[model samples]
Target chain A: METPCLVMDADLMEANLHTLQAAVNRAGKALRPHAKSHRCSRIAHRQVQVGAVGICVAKLREAEVLALSGITDILLTGPVADSTRLQRVPALLERAPHLMLVLDSHETARILHQSLAAHNRSLDILIDLDVGLHRTGIPPCDAVSFARALAAFPTLRLRGIQAYAGQVQHIRAFEERRTASLTCMKEAGQTFESLRRQYPACTIFTGGGTGTFDIDIEIPALTDLQAGSYALMDADYRTVQSRGCLTPTHTFTPPLRLLTTVIGTHHPSHVTVDAGLKTMYRDGASPVPAEPEWSHLSYEWFGDEYGRLLTPPGTRRPRCGDRISLYVSHCDPTVNLFDAFNMIRAGSPAETWPIDLRGCSQ
Target chain B: METPCLVMDADLMEANLHTLQAAVNRAGKALRPHAKSHRCSRIAHRQVQVGAVGICVAKLREAEVLALSGITDILLTGPVADSTRLQRVPALLERAPHLMLVLDSHETARILHQSLAAHNRSLDILIDLDVGLHRTGIPPCDAVSFARALAAFPTLRLRGIQAYAGQVQHIRAFEERRTASLTCMKEAGQTFESLRRQYPACTIFTGGGTGTFDIDIEIPALTDLQAGSYALMDADYRTVQSRGCLTPTHTFTPPLRLLTTVIGTHHPSHVTVDAGLKTMYRDGASPVPAEPEWSHLSYEWFGDEYGRLLTPPGTRRPRCGDRISLYVSHCDPTVNLFDAFNMIRAGSPAETWPIDLRGCSQ
Candidate 1:
């Protein structure tokens, strides 16, 4: 395998999948693993085989890729606001008929309705409610009003609501993360209950993430969970101890590993590796070396094409040709940087899975 | 144009090209623009047309794309350390006869030489010297020793040395940046002088970037300047006042504009856009709205697929369907995210240039 590539331990990933799926199943709620984390359609298939109801994607392009891969049940979690992107909706619907979309603004819904109505089609859409994240979606107070507005569009079907509290996914403290996520979901659930009273087809209350999955599954309103990073964990999630309070402690181990080669070891304090901000993204916490022997060293961004590991006292410094496996800081953006992941099964090469939906931000 | 896509003003970019090329020409040094900033082959061809002798790339994959596009004199600026990547040298050489690679370690050089020896071919290599970056490259004191070691290999030819002062590129103050860059280059020049006497083939002393190109050209030993970002300036470069000290204050105008659509206007304090960390990379400075009328708002990363512009007091808020043009925070990583550049010429669509070398980090 080449340096600066993603390597996934398939056995560990399979174990992670079963653990998360079993937990969600035990709670009697559906699991729609977010495909935006791992853009590969193969993984989405595996998720479906492991009892995932459907998959969620962040963009229309991601939906197009997954839909082409024959996964019909896909919910696009983000809004398609512009006309250019709205043009792609009909073609994707032709492939995956069960596709659902989220709508935060009436302006976007109106444009999408116009586009879909031209093709003599109707799309199932969920009212995206702002659960304190405020990034997208309508305010929770205006859910009924937004749904009433959507009633005017004949080409759009009213589904349930999607209220993902993305802001609480990385909270370090367990009680705080629980309280924050529950408070937001509780308010969103109240709005969903009111919307459910009005719309008969509005049954799917999909939301929650890996961080508060245990707490969120207890919510009677949340019919399905859209947790992504649980399938292939990263270093960023390990900081949240609350996520590990399940039956088996720390059930989700990081299956996704970043394999990088050391290029220069001349510097006494640090060794430069082939992976940098370009190979692995720089949004989240710094990546940690996967091996226990090199735990003393810390990763730092050198440039676009190089990263350096600071060698603490008594740390074993890596040589030029030596390879270092690292747990990626963040999974989603880092996955977007690579073309494919080298799948390893039982410490051997299994297959290479293409990141099919990479650069699907459109 | 689509939302969250890169748009380059061709005329402004052409002016930036002419201004920098003229400066380097007057200094009697070759201008080898780095292709990593703008991975499009069309832009590389444009840079060559504007008097660039060759182009520099950070990865072997980037070189492959540019070489396939008929760019012959390409320099792979970063080291290709492992055997898997070294095996590609012969094939690249077949396309680009003058393709040069950087070498920082004897382990990588031996592996590369062995690979080339198998193909019965020789390669041009530049010894990378550490200029206080401590990322890649050998120490300046070990340049001659490294050169002597290279003489032991038959498949590798000693072309020159490369010393890039990446640390001083973003220094806000002009005098501080100038002093730091000159100090590093002077030390590197002394090393080059010693190595030049030992190896007569060592003529091309290529280094420097858009940040230190002006200061580095003053060093008589620096035969070529490998500046990249001047062609399409970003919000990060605008902070470096020294880069603007050339003829006609602020000679390089930011031709690259990130076009995004307002997705949600439900929040009272801010409006959300369709560009986030995934659309525009979150390294370096925050992107500013291109229009002067909305200058009061500042950008904040909302999530992976959305960004928020906080509407301050007396600020005119954008509607749901309004378009926003922003100066990207960073150019290289942001360019890698997009597949094409929506070229704008004379307030009209000129062409769509594919970012052919995107996701070529390997």
Candidate 2:
């Protein structure tokens, strides 16, 4: 409830939820909002209330936390390799009952099967396919064999495939992003079709993030869209152009922001704020001042705990104790830095939501 | 306890504690290790046991966490701007009777005085001076006036000057780092001399990080060294060359690491690990494989939850489920991402130490 805290605009977030869900529904696809972005079960519940089929998490710990928070439906998009983490999956399944995991290799499948077999439980498994990201997933050529191998295990039920083109999610050019996303979706569609022929039981096909959700919704291959950042857009995502659009369409308002107070004004050209890399995520870009009056001032990383705002000549300089909202470069990692979100509704502080999965990365 | 958790080598960390503390002591300076680096009170307690006179924290929340963990002497190196945060300072002072805060402006001093005056308590205040970082702190020319303004408040006790040259802490050239640190120290010394002439009670002159701890210990102006990274060297600090050393001298072995498991091995040239920017800090650089066998494999950010290891021809390829330790790029932010440290002792799993101040960045 103070400076350097994560602030969420309830109205803007609600608009994002309704708009994106409506778009996905119009495209005849389900929306499984990725909880890794906000990491708040309250937000996830809101997404579910807005007509989300389920939620997707990136780690077992995230799944466990969401499950404990009473989120019964969860699809873990990332693979769990360590035996200790794999062992926890069955326990999570008992709580969330509708938990599904994504797998890429036979070795991981074997481990998951063994762990679930010991618990006398079965888990839904999705074959992750490599769709030009070259990050994770098995190749489409190997999808059939991988699915068959996973299906052989009685403790595992073969779901569809997961092809996420994360690298192309933030392409600046609208046509370029659309082309890249369509190409990957086409490949994933071919793989899903091949797998569907082999095992008719395969139905769930999920992938795509906030950057390509609109494009992905148009793809018949993706059964559900896993867009996480749309609800709380950041500075980096705001730069991305929509399909056939040259500039950011403002389809989603940046609901999440970092509230910081000016702590020092030692130099004539710069002032220091309380939030820096430690409080805000510094992956894609530096945070920008959200106020229109401070648009000329550029933000720079002063230290781990301080951010320096470069005041150009003739620009209105910030004074000590002045509070300002900063649009973060990235939202997911920034949300992970804090323990709770100071929710703002109707222009005032409403309530605080715990980032239940804040440090649940193990 | 599990893969993707932060691991600390106890032996290496202990050696670093003794070596750095002995170095500072030999130079006739007290060591107040910065808890922002590890955020674990157990490690801070170990540093105190090895001769650290006090500890340095970056936020009021961190001060409260450390004080609750029984670390009574704490110097909060960052300024608190918000009224809500300033009000918490008195509560922290109750827990940490020897609590000190750094201030840069008169506005902040007045706020602190007003808050503390209500509780009939006085706090030790250090005038933060600009040491070329231009991040936080008053310029040397304004130091005397600022100190006088702060001394006018009965609730505030002017302790000394805090001149931290944070920018020069990671300079690759040893002479460059030393020269920059010395130049700042000289200016600070001049300011301290001026302040001492008026108030002889000013004695606690502190500033300098791990990169310049040896250089700072030699500066007569600095009464104590605030070296946090010395106890747990990171990949970025390891690149800092000593006074005349060409390569990184093992002043401190990188005791902290992230243990990740190979979760996907679809491509022959690349494999995906469970830890990425989310699990490991990505401020200074990307994490590298710790083992010699995987030295040829370079690490890259695959996504939020996955790290891609690029294995060139002739390099040993990792298979799915193979766990390896990764040397983190930065220790402070990386440690802040975890709830606890999986401390390794004598090549075995040891006791866990909670990162008590992991998200204590209010």
Every model's TM-score on chain B: 0.96, 0.97
Look at candidate 1 and tell me the lDDT of residue A99.
92
Cα error of candidate 2 at position A142, Å: 1.9
lDDT of 1 at B290: 84
DockQ of 2: 0.73
List native contact recovery per candidate, as a fraction of 1.
0.77, 0.79
Model 2 error, position A84 (Å):
3.9
Evaluate every candidate with DockQ and list the scores: 0.73, 0.73
lDDT of 1 by residue, B161-278 (tens): 9999999988877778889999989989998898888889999899998888788888899999999999988888877776435332275889999998898887789998988988
- For candidate 1, write residues A1-362 as lDDT tens digits: 87789999999999999998999999999999999899999999999999999999998888988998999999999887777788789889999899999998777888889999999999899988889898888888889988998899999999899999999988877778888999999989999899889898999999999888898999999999999989888888876775446332276889999998888878788888989888888876789999898888899888888898999767678887789999998899889988899999999988999999998887
Model 2: residues with Cα > 4 Å off, grouped in runs: none
Docking quality category of candidate 1 according to DockQ thresholds: medium
